[model samples]
Target chain A: MKKQLMTGVLATLLSSTTMAATDITWWHAMSGQLGETVNTIARDFNASQDEYNIKPVFKGSYVETLTAGIAAYRADQAPNILQVADVGAATIINARGVAKPVEDILVESGYGFNNQDYIAGVRNFYADSNGKMIGMPFNSSTPVLYYNKDILAKVGVDAPKTYEEMEQVASKLKEQGYATFSQSLTPWIMFENFKSRHNLPVANKNNGFDAPATKIMINTPDMAMHFNKLKDWSDKGYYKYYGSDWDANQTPFEKEQVAMWLGSSGSFGGLRNRVDFELGTTYLPYWQSMNKDAGRTFIGGAALFAIDGKPKKEQQAVAAFFSFLTSPETQMFWHKSTGYVTVTKAAYALTKKSGYYQEQPDAEVGVKQLSLPGGEWTKGYRLGFYSQIQEIMHREFDNVFANRISVEKALNNIDKESQVILSRFARTVR
Target chain B: MEQRQQYTHSALPYFLLVPQIAIIAIFFFYPAAEAVYLSFMLEDPWGQSSLFVGLENYTILFNSTEYLKSVVFTLGFALVVSFLSLSIALLLAVKANNILHGKGAYKITLTWVYAVAPAVAGIMGGFMFNPHIGVFTEIFASLGWDFSLYTDPFDATFVLVLVSVWKQVSVNFIYFLAGLQSISYAVNEAAMLDCESDRRRFWTITFPLLAPTGFFLLVINLTYAFFETFGVIDTLTSGGPGGGTTSLVYKIYRDGFIGTDLGGSAAQSVVLLVLVLALTWVQFKFVEKRVHY
Candidate 1:
């Protein structure tokens, strides 16, 4: 009789404990090591509070997860939280009734969300013209130059600070029967970074941040001249075209086929594990003459968004989870483990105070590169139908790289196609 | 034609037909109807509100040069994949049917290729054609031709078509093999006694008997090339070296699912449905008459 009574009491206690905790689902696109970090944040947050639980789900790539989010939202089944890439910010912002701005959600709940606490470039990337935080920046990154130290020593050349010097070094490397540089042909490096590093305008309205719509101004003499140089380099067998895939581009560099690689800052951890030779890191190159006053590099990683139209309890739980994720301790742990830039200033200061950069110099390059003051264009490009516009850029670039079209034609094509997409998106928003 | 037993009650026929009708209604007709409905409206990513946009979506797609290019590309791709897969599989099936020793082994080995998913086949193709570290690239380099598929549109599209054909030949092989097995040995023996060339005998008797199967396989192969090669194109070229290999189905998937352009993608899907439907009808109307069975 005493055992039965004890069982009934324990069952009742379990049910009540479950009732008190509101579960908030976070659908993210982080995979492999980064995926582990996502789960760790959720697990820690759940363990810290009995009032809420965060459920982490892996939903393939950014495009797929964004598509999934859209489908679910249409069905009124969106998760409480979502992870959207930097490129998708414009679309997410225009999702009027779908995504609740992180600032709005926290403010509504009477929770503290300091917009100024995040790194300036990150804050700008996830903000609107009013600098209102729409998404909480997480796992943000930028492109950096990675070189094989052995090749650098053999060639007797220091790291390049400008595009002109990079060409000279590449020419020397090519003469010695070595491929000079390889990189994935992405807009981050091919289009946006070049514009940012050169201090050139990517669009008419400061990379589409100042207005609801903007026309591209990238069809200019600066871009054409730079790509003309690239075309010449390609003809000389110095600039090898790696496929437009990130993982595929890494193989040529890791196998010592290419001496220098321009890749994502987040790739630091993986490259360290795989390469047998000592590695060197530096900021991306600038156009010395045209870009006398260059700006900071643009970021490429994703951010956390609090989804809209959930129950009040669930929305509160999501706000609690965001605070947990952006905490200095959690951000620092995430930054150290994945080589992604820590989003918060508190996390940045904490890691620096611990002398983390002194030990791993390569890990600091991304943070240092983005530390420079950023204007509207330098914050990053954010435009609706960005994925479509990106594809258009890729297609034009591909044709140019294949020698089917001149750089002038490619840039012209990109400008024309992008305007159409932007105009369509403008209509949608209206 | 095979004989069927007559059923007395009309209810029994309708009863037997219920499950199939229900399945067709739920799975095929319902989604198709929804796709048509969606094609007429501007549906945002989050489906909170969808506006009626009339023919704007279709007009936009029609005006885009890339969409038209994809139409021509898909037609060329489907033709090549269909012809090559059918001819190659038929030749192999003929050889395998004749071989008395290790026939099952040969058949099973050829059959297993179909078991591989389209995406897996594409990934395998990617490894072989990857310019940076591919074994085939090295081999071609040594032979005085630098066969890099990454930068060249022709090379990339060729790989997409080749991998898709490699995946589809297995299904064609099974049907052709079954067709070859159905022919009686006695007929061939009787023809041999009359003293004609073996090649001529095959042309006159065996080939004609295989027409019904060939026609069936051709229709299936064309449809496979048109509709089922999306994953192969995705993993192989991603519709580049400059949209060189973007097929109709692939564009629909990219626009609708990846880019989240619901109205645009739905419009494209509706067009694709009509195109395939007309093509199938034409094939049945003109080509099926020649089949001996």
Candidate 2:
């Protein structure tokens, strides 16, 4: 009777162990190569572990994915993990109780939480004012200058070292019948890149990353100067305004109709397979007459946040996945596969030691550009209504480009709209 | 007995309308009521916490220069596009009605063009007018004109209006043709016997007879101009050349979805809904009375 009871207990234990493996849903916006990379990582993790199984789903683009997640949340069917873009950060933050802080998840899961492991510029974005990390650093990237070497060589213009040099090269390229120096005039490229390269403040409180209630500083002298440059170039037919965002302007670059393009470094992997010409990567140019050192470019990619309202077991699983995601090996795999900068210092060191940079020079540009001192603007601006500000800036800048208004008037209008939005956002936060 | 039978027959029709009423109540009326209710409330990023703020959204909208400008812009666009499309469609329909030999072929061709979605037509039109590779751009440049629709607000608006008319004219054309065909040949004979010229007869008799169709087309074209052309704006200009082409619906999309200002967007949407409803009612009261039928 004792032997039969012992056998029965062993059988029940085996069945319960089999049933313990839980499936967690992860909703992401990545597709194509990036999507495959996410799936591969999830597969590797699942294979290595027997307790939790992660199910990855490609929802859509960043906005679409976020909208879908919100809809799902309304229906009480949200995913366990969501990858939100940098622009969506404020929205997520404002969505209190809807997201679990990564720091809390890590601690609860018994993992050692180290905020110092992440790059300061990147980590600061995911952290609250009290210095608690809110999200996991996933694929962080910054904009860089991408030039067609053949076109540059033909125009006798070496890769532009300064904004003035870039202007001169654009003229030469236009003279050589290139017709367009750059395809797209994306607001981020025009405003953020220009602001960071000049070390100009886009807002108070270190471009709003230090304080959320800070107002916009877009109508400043530096911004005016930048606008003037763009306007002059546009008038001179050196810059062809593609109208609106970068996606609309990508056609010309893919066809080699444009000489230069300013876009995220994350595009390197995708462009590598498409472009027929030699693509040279360089740090974004600054005002030549301004200070020689402007620091690193501002980061412009998304991070993964652990949503709130899940069971402790699920939170523990998410934390383990997050920790594994930021590990050096995983970072290297992500960087090599997607051209996004590895967020961790250890990953960068590993890449250096492995001589990956020597093999692929394009990957080195992002690291070198980000290794600079990252001044006030380069720290990555965060505000409650940045997306609105961006839209207003783009609208006003487009007006400037169209000669509908003077650069001064456009800047003033941008300031006015931005102030209104900022004040409204401040009231809400309070 | 006959009066009782007529009452029972009328009751069947009322019973038949019940399902449609249920559908409209569930889908349209409920959401519209909810939008109005939410417009008076403050919204957050998560779209969860909404607090009632009586008339705050409307007051803010009324105070905003941007919102006021968009209102004017949307009104101008809707009026201009509707008139242009109706006039062109009426002319084409009349011309096709006069043609006896190839009217079928003409209608088939026009129908094919109309069958193509507005988005596809907008894309094709964008490429055709694109400054870089567009044939129209080459021609305009050769004529010593700047003619860059992307850079010029007037030019962008012109392109939008032209595309809007092109996409909508076919539907109105069919309506006009149907109206013309339904008119008895006896009316034209009587006008002729009264010594009215062909142009005079058309203006006095045929045109008046087509008023009902015109009114219907006006409502449809105006709504299409307001809502359906969001794709055209998105694909062609994206409300650019400095918000010169941002319609009310497009503004709602940009604010709500792209800018993530749900409260402001919902408020804007409520404003748009009210404007549309008011205009539609006015059109019905004034214009619909002109329809003889």
DockQ top scorer: 1
Query: What is candidate 1's lDDT per residue for A1-430, written digit by digit as tens?
Result: 9999999999999879977789888999999878998888888998898999889999999998898887777677888888899778888877676678888888778787778888766777787777788888888899989999998788888878788899889888877788888777567786788877766677776677777565876688887887888788888877766656676677889999988889988888889889999999998888888866666887888988888878988898888877888889998999999999988889989999989988888998888788776654676666887788888877887788788899999888988888877876766674
Scored by TM-score, the top model is 1
Q: What TM-score, to 2 decimal places, does chain A of model 2 have?
A: 0.90
Q: What digit string (tens of lDDT, one per residue) describes model 2 on residues B210-287?
A: 888888888899999899988888878888767788889999888878776666788888888888899999989998
What is the RMSD of candidate 1? Answer: 3.3
> lDDT tens string, model 1, B1-293?
13443544469778999999999999999999999999988865776557888998999989999999999999999999999999999889989988999999999999999899999999999899888778888898999986867667788887887899889989999999998888898988898998588688878988899999999888998988988898898888888878888899989888887677788999999999999999989998999977768
Worst 10 residues of 2 chain A by lDDT: A179-188
- Candidate 2 chain B lDDT trough over 10 residues, lowest sum: B42-51
Off by over 4 Å in 2: A1-20, A31-33, A167-180, A183-186, A197-200, A247-258, A270-276, A352-355, B1-18, B48-52, B189-196
